[model samples]
Target: MTAAARLLDDVCHLTAQSLNRLETSEHFRVVKMLGEGSYGKVVLAVHNQSASASVCPGSPMALKFFPRATTSLCSFLREYNLSLRFCTHPSLSRALGIAYLTPSHYVFAQQAGLFGDLYDFIVPEAGVEEDRCQRVVSQLSGALSHLHSLGFVHRDVKPENVFLCDAACRWVKLGDFGMAKARGTKVPEVWYRSPYCTPEAETARGDGDGAGERSEPEEKKRGPRVWASVEPSVDSWALGVLTYAMLTGAHPWPQTSSDCGAYLKYLHWFRTAKSPEEELDLWAEPQHQGPDGTPADFGAKEQPSVAPQFARFTPLGRAFFRLLLNPGPADRGRPEDALGYLGGAWVPVGERERLEERRKKSRGGGGGGAVNEVKLKDGRGLR
Candidate 1:
């Protein structure tokens, strides 16, 4: 038997004594692998127990298995605690149960996203319809806001981590809490962050904001505490990027890194909007016009207002997105602020059908799940 087959076979024969020191339930029939990540793999499963006490009978679930040898139990516990802590929120994927099968792996079950993730649903050069985008952004806004309120920040927020509960995206949830950390904790290494989602850390030179390795003077500085702490605002920045990406099927900038010219250009534009030397202009926002010739104002601040990448959104949407993507951590208002822009269209309604058609085509483009199709001795693929 292959090493993979033997490991799973060992798991299949789990008994009550096989349950390590963790809250666990009955055995499960592994159907097929759903996906895998750096830490472990997730498989689709259903309860195999005949006992009347089964919480779910035939319903499918996503079972995440972390091999003990490759993953630390403390990491597993952290993710589980955080996931269960936020499970009550409607916009978060619920944790079904958890188990530590003696020798093979530590496993946990979560409600599955059968339709796939938003990454699969999004198309390049053209994004989801405005109505659908509105629904998704609103849900994520709520989810992020809830997380922040609980003093945590979801360090990763991108299309791939956002799961679709349905094809039309009427219901979506923020999943994959492995990178999540409490506010005020030391931020993870830059290499661990999701590109374009997390803000680029200030360089050692202290180029932009001036509080790093070389301050006003290295001597005057008490110490070179360069790395930043985790802030709840990161989720808002990521949400804004995700919003614009989903609307235009492209990123506003490649990423917020100093190395990228696109990001540098965007950074300059963002700074210009906040420049005190520049004169303020009160321009009428698009789609906010009343019956009269005058525009109805919703009190949005003045921004550069002419980003080619964000042209897909209306002036109103751009204004809100600017607020969300603001580089200044203290100023990047709450994700709940997106609620105010929820009533209006994010993108033009005329392009809805075209966007939907693109989404449909992308969904049908089949590249199967990330399963390693290894089979057992019986030739039944390890079920």
Candidate 2:
């Protein structure tokens, strides 16, 4: 059987068994289910049973089940692998490990962050502010900068993938790296709020002054395809949409319930706003006429302007939307450059140090808090 097929069979067989009974590690105990998504199921588990003999250190953890046949398996594995690649970042979630129950079936484990996702937090019910929104955006952009510099693209940059844990979530943690693609490779997943889609270039040439007809491939292979394919800028585009939602609590473009309607709008945005270079010029020369030959408007009383939508943002925020979301890849700011614009101003070392310091204090108190107390007869007891 193919790898995918074999994996599906293994998943079917293993899922039939009592998954709750499976012991991934000696330190944690299976508690109960937490939530389920398109990717898989998340279970709330704790280390209550292993305080005496547990070698693992955390108090409680989350267990994520990734079925082989489901799209979530690939996404889970992708997150597991990429998380390892950028394991040390404080703003990024720590991936514990992966457990392959069967040849094809597996579970990804990680240290759980406190809040669920930004989407649940930033809705009309939550009622956040502009400065707070800017802080979270800065943290995410910083994290994205790190990821992009490491040659990875987070194809999915929606609020659902960003976790907010600490007070006010002045601190931010990025989750769900399943749709991320390597820097140079093309990913095929659909994006909902990305302003920058991949650009497809069509070089048009014809006879000019007796010159022979010449043509070039509109789609370039080495770099980003301008119109047809979505590139890394899609992340920036999504960030813009996110910023808009965070500030105004509404979508930049019209939102629809039907998948078809939503997609039509998405495509329209993709085709119309495919070039970032042009967008930058719009801000640079507001008084100049556009290529379609119409004067750009910045002072229209009824319409929103870049200056105002970006008023509450820092210099970095303005640059992020302008350059990072440049409709074209060439115009869009390089992830590193965009991050450099952020500089050291928005360092994201929120409560991690405080929490760790507290843990040390607690452990220093000589309570039986050290998780390594279980004296295995041998150095290694269970494999």
lDDT tens digits by residue: candidate 1, 263-309: 66666666655332122122423446533322333224322344545
lDDT of 2 by residue, 1-383 (tens): 22433443455454435333344646457676756765677776765443233225545666767667754444545566566446456677666543444444467566676666676544331124445676776788778877766666676676656676764878888877766665556323222212222222211111121122224542232233222333557577667666655644444333211233543444454354424344434346335533322333423421233333333332233445566545455656654455444332211122223333543554466432112221221111100
**Which segments of model 1 are wrong by more than 4 Å?**
1-26, 50-54, 188-197, 204-225, 274-305, 349-383
| Residue pairs that clash (backbone atoms under 3 angstroms), model 1 | none
Candidate 2 stretches greater than 4 Å from native: 1-21, 24-27, 30-34, 48-58, 71-76, 102-105, 125-127, 187-230, 255-320, 335-383
Q: State candidate 2's TM-score.
A: 0.56
Worst 10 residues of 2 by lDDT: 374-383
Question: In angstroms, how far off is 36's CA in candidate 2?
Answer: 1.6
Indicate the TM-score of model 1: 0.73
